[model samples]
Target: MTTPAAPARRVPEAVHRRRWVILGVLMLSLLIVVLDNSILNVAIKTISTPAPTGLGATQSELEWAINSYTLVFAGLLFTAGLLGDRLGRKKVLIGGLAVFGIGSALAAFSGSPAELIGFRAVMGLGAAFVMPATLAVLMNVFERDEQPKAIGIWTGGVGLAIAIGPITGGVLLDHFWWGSVFLVNVPIVLFAVALMLWLVPDSRDPKPGRIDPLGVVLSVTGLVLLVYGIIKGGRLADFTDATVLSTVGAGLAVLAVFVVVEKRSDHPSIDVTYFRSKVFSAAIAAVALVFFALMGVTFFAVFYIQSVRGYSPLDTGLLLLPLAATQMIFAPRARLLVDRFGHRATTTGGLVMLAATLAAFALLDADTPIWFLEVVFFLMGTGMAHVMTPVSVVIMQALPREKAGSASALSNTFRQVGGALGIAVLGSVLSAAYRTDIEDELGLLPPGARHAAGESIEATLAAADRLGARGEALVGEAGDAFLHAMHVTALWGAGVAVAGAIVTALFLPGRTPASEGGDRNQELAPAAER
Candidate 1:
């Protein structure tokens, strides 16, 4: 007779009792990672200014500062998750927090744009380990029935970071130099580390797979090459450049090889077979596409509010309050909608709402009422809350409890990769469009400066400033160019969101019978496994 299978492990009662507190600690850890990005958004203009006030970095350099963090975070997340599963999550969490704190300190004192970008990558390495570990530990501590509720609350923490990051950065900018925004993270990291050591318990997979070093190398290499090419294309505003084509083509080729290698590996970092389920694949795709649309739109929205409308950083942050408020209000409650309408209807509806909000950007101009933009932001946040909560539940619930680390890693990797691409692609679109519209007006500057001025609205404005009273006409022209570019990028974002809606409607499951109840694990299992 075959040997009996081992019984499932149970969560300790003491651990169960303090699960909420553990979640609170995990959120605290998550806050600093996300907070850094949001704070950077509000400070981008200051960072683009000349020395003393800012770094004097160009728009392309600024995009690299953001994408460097995201690309590293995206590329290493799967491997980091596997490490957490093999070792202990608490150990990894502490280690990651320490690294992030060190990176933040180094980044705060960076003397140049290149140094800042390099330091941001170090922070990304730490964030890769922290993000998946939080969700994985939560999965282990909570019962399956409670996982959805726990994940919803976890998703809401992202909104909390979004709420706090910009306003905090604005306040810091008002009083201190731009570096203060990064410096603020050090104290929060220290506090979070203390709380994690005290409250969060260690957890890991009982039978972890071997480390796939080759797979890790291939994935990171491919992603960096791919993102570098995309960013380069954006900087040149020419996707057809010989260098762009070669790098993008090579990146795609390597990633294809990675897929083939993983398919044949006995102990892959990511189990490629799990994606056989249509529902699982669709859910992950939805996460990626929605972020792709939203992140791209947000990249331009900051400039539109600050540079075009002439709002101070603090005012811009306050204006964004509606976005964060609606997310916090609706994120946890999204589960109610999922229970009533099912993931298919809920996610599809949310994407539709998101698409509408993105398209509404076309209606905005320098003179539009501020309240009108706030309403759009509010609705956009509501839609995002619904989509994120339900899809996170779907992705996390699809895997076995033992594979929670991998599950969380896969979900987050796609989200980060999507966001990174969005910023690169849409930022390029905005750049190209702005250049096309403003090139004629740039004739007032020297030929050497005209190309640089045409690169971005900020660059244009800086060039115009040096011209004194003679540059007043160029300022009005720059605003018009940026608004036109924003309109074009918004429509592109809306189109991508609509594509996500269609994918969800076609592949995500409809309502299940009441008899099935909370047994979503079995329901979402791959057909091959069944």
Candidate 2:
């Protein structure tokens, strides 16, 4: 041999012992990001109440508040991942935490809806950096054999956030101002910052490459425009609207341009060819579809429990706890199932379970029993746990550790886009059905009240409350209308989940012991070595 290749260095014993502690810090970061979104969702009603204390935002403005965060977060994710890879993961993580805390502080004191929306976008920027860094750090810290267990634990923390966020927001709203939801992130961010500094190590790409500024511009513009179009279309229920069509068309065009550009670049921002791997493509699709169905169901479920069933926010949160509980319980166990039965079986089985749950939910009416709701909620959680956890593990295995930041950001981007589309499409379906049902019933109300009643369930209930006996009658009619809408939405979600199940079955590669690291290692080596 011309020269002997050096043996790979062993990880220090100290690092092995501290890796679990490092994971705790990473999860803390993940939890804050997850909780920020969930808490904002639960706090929307309080924040949008009539002025003096609340901001008095319109329906469109409220949607903007949520969508602004999601759009900005999604758009910046790829750039954020690249930054973390080039500049040191721990450094980016800390900077993100600081920026996030500042955004939260500003958001808490915002005097108007516009101010809050802008600040939320700032938080999104910070979240973009944090999300990728956490997963990248995990990858660098853990060896391949240990990744499944670590990922299981990481996903469990995400499940716990889902369980806690609504309840926490509900409790805060019951006793405090709506701004308390934003303020809560401050302390958590501080704690995570401190812990990460002490426990986590800095890591970066071995061979840093030039940043592709044009790629960043193209990706961000494409995502923001696409999401904006979807949100506007869903709210209006008019896909043919000139503004929506133009915006979405432009977004698609830019994304196509981005694909061509990435193909030609020597060091592309994202390697589009990664989709060539069956496992990689399947995991991304599974995540997107699963989230699409899940988000649609949850969006309506909150309204069903609170408006139709007449539960308090706290009570509603408690009612939804079963969903989170089952997810948490089964997430870790999903890895065990993967070890025993293989990823294909577990993933498809989970999808089938979710489809069945959605189908059963489609049959429920306003008078459906609470016990039935609880059972299905738990079952939905179980199905999601099985599907999401294994899919995440497979995604991690499909990509090389060196590309972890980009891969993680790519996975998260699909999830956000899927969730946004789900809310838009399913919401449009629900809105169309509800408006049709309510239109016939609204003729009995005062002309002024009729328009308000037709707008939304909340507005309908408020209008009814003002009308006394007429209001009571209207409430019953509105509840029935909402139930009908819920049924239609559930059916659509069921169909999506079934389609996802079939796709999962067809696209997800069969597992064999030799296939896990072998192919990915061979494919990733050239770039990784550079």
TM-score of each: 0.97, 0.91
Instruction: State the lDDT at 194 in candidate 1.
Output: 91
Clashes per model (N, Cα, C within 3 A):
0, 0
Instruction: State the TM-score for model 2.
Output: 0.91
Poorest lDDT segment (10 consecutive residues) of candidate 2: 521-530
Q: Write the per-residue lDDT of candidate 1 for residues 208-282, one digit (tens) a residue.
A: 878888888888788778877877776777789999999999888989999999999998866788888888989
What C-alpha lDDT values do all the predictions have? Answer: 0.89, 0.79
lDDT of 2 by residue, 1-530 (tens): 58888555344566767889999899999999988877766676666565655786644566667767776777777778888989999999999989999999999888999999899999988988998899989988887677878888888877888889889888987888888889999999999998987889899988665677888789778876776676566555567899989989998899999889987988777677777666677888889888888877877787788788877667777787888888878898898777677777889999988988888877777778999999998999999998888888777666667778888888887777677667666766776677777878777677766654575676676677667886687888888888888899899998898888888888765554645545644443343223
- Point to the candidate with the largest lDDT: 1
Clashing pairs in 1: none
* Candidate 1: C-alpha lDDT: 0.89
Q: Which pairs clash in the backbone of model 2?
A: none
